[model samples]
Target chain A: MVQPEKARSKIRIYMDILQAVQDDGMAKPTRVLQKANLSHERLTRYLGELVQKNLVKENQDEPGVRYYTMTEQGIRFLQELRKAESFVSGFGFEF
Target chain B: MPFPFLYLDTSFYFLSGIVAFLVSFYAFRYTRLIENSALRFLSIGFTVLGVGLLAEAFIDTLSFFIPSTSSYLLLHRLIIREAAATYSFLQVLAYFVILMGYLLSRRGPASAASSNGSMNRPPTIGFLASATSVVLASRLGELGVLIALAREIIIISSALSMAFLVAIIYLDSTGYLKHRNKQAILVLVGFVLILASQAISFSLGIVAARALGFSEILDFIGTAVQFAAFLSLLLFLIWRGKIGSTGKSAQ
Candidate 1:
């Protein structure tokens, strides 16, 4: 029997988003949507939360053009999240 | 740790404690990174069990080094027995905690996520609960031993704890089956070996009745199997966490 794919966990999503932003140094929403494979609404909401958490910063210095860049905290968070992911999954968890 | 009952092999217990410590460390260290209460409980369970094994190991070492000609032999032996009762208590408690983790995790991921900040006080509470039980059980266990009933009770309780663990591991294996995970298969086999060791020891009566030294040989085999089980899990955890990971598989 074919098993249904497990949904991406919230932490996984966060990791992907952080990685997407970090890869380009700074990223637009569309780029993040493409890289992270998230819907526009989810990317906006998650990015907003990440920004509020100080993991990410959204810049809108130029009118109507915004970019998301990873904070030092965000980079650290991603690295730790990756490690944590590896840690739990190694023990046969869903992660 | 195998319930050798009378055997005080300090080195074996000490090494078992170290292996348990490493496994518990792996489970405990990542709790801050994830909102999984199951992980937290697994951490707590292993931590309690590891501490119990290490403490028992120390007490056993103390008992082992003193000469039989020493005047304090009887008193030290009493201390060691009492310590074994405590160790047994902690072993059962550890299994209970791990079982509770499995039970709670069955409630699904949402509940685990909701439990994020609510768990800060649990370790303290757990410590307080167990500390009180340790005092009562350790002292009362001495009296129980004088009456020759404590060992029986310990065996029964240990059996129940083993039952709980068997059920949990059975469930865990089913999950592993679903995933077809080879690493999990290694873990499953390891657990099976440990359980089989217990089964062998528990039948020591029947085995001993059939032959004299055969039971002792079986005892040695059981201990070896238990040690191998611990070593296998420890090595798997190290490999999975370090060199074997590609970081994409979990995601």
Candidate 2:
């Protein structure tokens, strides 16, 4: 049976990004984009928003090489969203 | 004892209660996961529902085991009546709490912490309901008058709780439409069925019931319908939990 794909929520997208970063240790943007299953344009926009929100921090190891790690706020946000998602989804609710 | 049980039976209420508890258990787990105190109202309601039905079953079972000999028949009836009243009061309370929880959930997280305050707790109502039950249980010689008053109390409380159920069903309908959730639809159906059952019982509460002379019959029908409703919920919740979501995945 083919299940139709549902549109991912913004929070889901954000969490996917955070999760990718969390899994990668210090996440490269390329890897985060792939793991989060987002297009380059969308990833750039979301990552920028995330960094601005202080949920993710950007670091330059050397000159132009950028890596991201989840800020404490980002980790907490992801955890809370995960909890809310599981709970509300069980009831077929819009998280 | 024989008359009431003959109509309502013990198993229906007891079994329905177990279903309510299962639903409540699910809610409780979510509350812990989210660390939200507001959701506790929803869980608490289901727990009370389970307890009330189970208690009714326990009381009925206790009465059944007692000697129904002619000498003890009066005492038996008294006990049965009181137990039924107690169960009714609990039903009223369970519905009330569930309604409150549903409303609070809609209001969202801001209300959650503040709701923990004593003001939200209906301690007086609980005290009055439980106190009435205790009064009935003591088997004081004033059985006739006290039982009549208890019946009125049950009727009024049941009416109030049904109002609560109405509000919940209304909110649920709007919510269900937006979510398109399968299990939620099942729960909504269950609520409607229970409400129908309440209507049947409401008929029994009216003076017309004695004139109709089918209190036992109406009571039985109501219990059976309620039992079926709860059973449906229990079965579906378990079944759906395995299959997982319908792919809606909103909020």
Candidate 3:
């Protein structure tokens, strides 16, 4: 479970959405909205960006219910982000 | 007055340089992953430092290989002196930029993580060019003597910068303890060892060990300690990567 952060940057928000999707395994729109704390419009816009960036993929199993899944690049990006955060945080930064 | 344990000292620096360059590679990769200017600066700083250490090692090796003729000796001296000055200057600059990155991270995380807008050319390049010019200029006429004198001062200042880096990392480690971060503890220990190494190097002043056995001993100890510091960081990174793959914290 990812802890909800306050006033995240655009990048941070992207990370949050990715983490939420990863946590959910096959993230439904409502679950991601609740986890990312973004309105439908905002979530839609960011999800498009994430899909375009190749960090996230939008898939539908049956019909209308869209599930967001993290791509390989997305997972790698998250891992790198964690390492970078820890690297600098070792120097007292809340990265 | 040939140096004692010269090969050992150079080997340690070479190993340390290899480690620094490895870390720099990963840091630079991370900058591409994230939108953090601090990460970019940190990457650049470590790259400069890694290259500087390697340069020093190369210069030391060159001294041994250069033909001992009078003209060769003069050329050798000029090359080593200029290289040493540049190495010292880079040491200071690298540590200073790293310090600035940490400071910026603390003050305004947002600003520090912001994209490099309008920063067409990094300030580091200008610093290197200017510092190189000043060091090269000191190689002229009567000022050459002054450069010889100033070389010791530069080395001392470089050691002090290392000390300053240790202090900053040490302070940062206290916060790490509060967060119960094992990785940070490893980094703290590494810096402490590096700090001790720099202090020994500063006090020894053994560019040419003139039968001073104690200075040689101190130099050996410093080299050994610095190697350990680099090893610690390397191990931490490796261990952290393993844990990260498992989605767990080492703490």
Candidate 4:
């Protein structure tokens, strides 16, 4: 029997949001929702986590409008993720 | 050094230690981010291997300063020979630890992923200390025969270790790991080259110091081949870092 695909890991989800913000240079919640392919609620929750970890910073450009920008720590985390990926891939395993 | 083997061996041990230390440093840093048990084990194993090489290098260095006085010369030679055994013991242990780490990775992904704890340190020190003592206390007679037997055993063990690594890596490529790409090829080539060097040494029966020049030449070639293997791994790690910085595929 085929097994269901395992849920994406937390680090992976972290990478997704970071990448979204990085790609946009500064991402809106809606833009990140689309880029990271996460539900609005899930994106909001993860963004909260990223902010808590100081990986991403949020700025309210105006009333009811917010943008998410990756902090230096967030950028470094993403780089670390990439390195882990490359190293694991060298052994033919998914990180 | 008076003996060519001592000179070549000193250089080999120092270089090997440096290479292993560098690899261990990278491994330890990566483990901090990944938090994989297997990665931590790898870091620890390489660290132990590096320390073993450094210890051997130190002993070889000390051997050079031994006085040629008739009274204590025999004792000095005995100590040097014992140190060689100690070095071999460490080599065997290091490879075994690294092999276990690789095996651990294969047990299941979650096994490595879930264990975010750091490597335990006390057991490592205790194990090394106890093993070294046992090797040191082991009895020996007739230095020439002992050296030959030690070399033979080391060559055999090294060959076996390389074989195990090759098999493990091959399985890694074809199994769930699916690493059958350029990087896998590079790793495989590196291991194979090292295996070949061990095989060459084994065939040469390099234990008896009869043709010291020829034996040193063979050993030099083996050391060079092993260095190349370490170089390939180093190149791969650097390339990986470059890929990481460029924001390419997370894979």
Best model number under TM-score: 4
**Candidate 2, B10-94: lDDT as tens digits:** 8787778888888878777666655445457767877777877787788778888778788776566566556666666777877
Docking class of 3: acceptable
Worst 10 residues of 1 chain A by lDDT: A85-94
DockQ of each: 0.28, 0.13, 0.37, 0.48
Q: Residue B70, candidate 3: how far off, in angstroms?
A: 13
**Candidate number with greatest DockQ:** 4
lDDT of 4 at A43: 95
Give me the runs in candidate 2 sitting further than 4 Å from their true place.
A1-94, B1-8, B69-71, B109-130, B133-140, B207-213, B244-251
Worst 10 residues of 2 chain B by lDDT: B242-251
TM-score of 1: 0.73
- Report lDDT (Cα) of residue B114, candidate 2: 45
**lDDT (tens digit, per residue) of candidate 3 on B167-193:** 567556765865577777776777777
**Number of clashing pairs, model 1?**
0
TM-scores of all models? 0.73, 0.69, 0.77, 0.78
Candidate 3 chain B: worst-modelled 10 consecutive residues by lDDT:
B117-126
Q: Could you tell me the lDDT of residue B220 within candidate 4?
A: 63
* Whole-model Cα lDDT of every candidate shown, in order: 0.65, 0.69, 0.69, 0.67
Reference contacts preserved by each model: 0.18, 0.07, 0.42, 0.50
Worst 10 residues of 2 chain A by lDDT: A86-95
i-RMSD per candidate, Å: 3.4, 6.1, 2.8, 2.7
